[model samples]
Target: MKNTPIGRLRLIGLLEGISYLVLLFIAMPLKYFAGFPVAVSISGALHGLLFVLFCLAILHVMFVHRWSIFRGFWAFVSSLIPFGTFVLDKQLRREEA
Candidate 1:
């Protein structure tokens, strides 16, 4: 899947989504309820790195596919919402097929 621009974007988006979820559900809870600030520190850093990669992947795909600005904007917006990337994955998979 990594051979093509869309494929790479999908893979990075999935990873970024999972990292965001981990940071939100596990790391944040650990920081607040379990008195483990390190959990957030680690997961937050991972999520941040993945998010930057995701942005770069989006740009790569946008340029390769000639996506409309609105489509690119939607892609960026999807990264902000929980589970949004999974939903975006469905659309991307259709495009891939």
Candidate 2:
């Protein structure tokens, strides 16, 4: 899990997805309801960084794994939806096998 490209990409996707959820459900609420803008500031930055990394991972996987354009697009789109990456990760695992 630690040594392969797909493993690295899976890890990145999970982190990025969790950060996105945290930013949306937790940090955003904290900013709006609790008047704590700092939560958004920090969480936003982390999510942004993770998202960029996820994009790069997709590109790497495209080259390394020879992913089709549609597959890569779904991976990109999945990152934008809640719990999408986890679902996509399962698909990816089946593909790996």
Best by lDDT: 1
**lDDT of each residue in 1-97, candidate 1, tens digit only:** 5468889889999999999999999999999999999999999999999999999989998999999999998998899999999999899999998
Model 2 weakest lDDT span, ten residues long: 1-10
Clashes per candidate, residues 3 or more apart or on different chains:
0, 0
Off by over 4 Å in 2: none
Residue 39 accuracy (lDDT) in model 1:
96
List, residue by residue over 3-91, the lDDT tens digit for candidate 2: 57787788889999899999999999999999999999999999999999999999999999899999899999999999998997888
Task: Please give the TM-score that candidate 1 achieves against the real structure.
Answer: 0.97
TM-score of each: 0.97, 0.94
Residue 64 alpha-carbon offset, candidate 1, angstroms = 0.7
